[model samples]
Target: MTLSNTIRWLGMLAVIGGICRLLMTPLELMWGTDNTTALIIGGITGSVFIIIGTAGIYLFQAEKAGVLGFIGFLMTTLGNILVCTMVMIALFVNTALQDPQILEQDLPGPIVPIRIIMMITMNLGYILFGIATIRAKMLPRWGGALMILLVLMTFIPYTDYLFAVVWGLFYIVLGWAVWSRSKNSETKVSVTQ
Candidate 1:
């Protein structure tokens, strides 16, 4: 398929991902992270779609996005992938198998540092992506602004749940922006023809 087509489809997927992300808050509140089903639906399966969606978001404006955009894309993708890994570990290795000690007992080296690094990269990545998105002007500017502000919000105490809600809204706006923009451009092309 053409790149444009791919991006449009991915944007649709982003809508799906956003819905799943919104569900995360309620799922966590209900199941408290122990339910594997909730974990998978809330983030595991959703993350795959989110990665694809965000890739489309970046590629949609790669030309205008430039170097900072590229770096932001990399970090954003990396952070998402890393979170997926951690979620899988939490679900299967920790929950299904019920081997809480296995992670600490069988791990190679210290994992605390790695986790901290992930956290740092994740926060920075979101901020970078937000700035890049705004500068690119391909997606919704408000969504980009929301991304940066949401990262800042993470610093507030007891605001963890807010993330799922806001991020869901962010992706929804992003996807809608992509969808509408492409459709508008296509209409213009047809009119010109």
Candidate 2:
């Protein structure tokens, strides 16, 4: 429907996806075996999260989002797509071929560079996006600043999941802000009309 609605829904998806990701480790532990199921769930949700989250961030005020925001969206989205594709392949191999050992093997030579690029792009892109969001002033200042800070925080040991949840919360807040603004604007227009 409206751009605000789209962003709201996408933000919800990001939240759900983040929760799914956070569950992966615990689920694997409970199952006490293969991580195939967890990987599949995480990969699917993670893909949705990254793609939609990037779009919501990029389109928040596209005209004012700036070059860094654009680059951030492209890099993060592409990197997530690549990583998700690899995860899907892993799922297929584990399920169809019943070969978990394949995953243990070192990635092929060609894939190594791609993995490195994905890591750099996904991390750097989000950082830039956060900065751009702050500069654009489309969302709350603290939300944007938190985004940048959370991304940086991921580098700390044992904080990946913690920051991920916070990141998802940021999306939720941004989505609510956009949705509320749109609703208020619509109400004002109706009254004037």
- Considering every candidate listed, which one attains the maximal TM-score? 1
Q: Report the C-alpha displacement of residue 44, candidate 2, in angstroms.
A: 1.1
Clashes of each: 0, 0
lDDT tens digits by residue: candidate 2, 1-193: 8656676555556555555655665666666334776776666665667566657556655567767878877876887788776777777878888877877788786667877787787778778777788887867877677677776786778774465456556666665565555554431111121
lDDT of each: 0.75, 0.66
Error of 2 at 79 (Å): 1.7
Best by lDDT: 1
What clash pairs does model 2 have? none
Over the full model, what C-alpha lDDT does candidate 1 score relative to the true structure?
0.75
lDDT of model 2, residue 72:
73
**TM-score of model 2 vs. true structure:** 0.73
Of candidate 1, the 10-residue stretch with the lowest lDDT total is 184-193
| Candidate 2 backbone clash number | 0
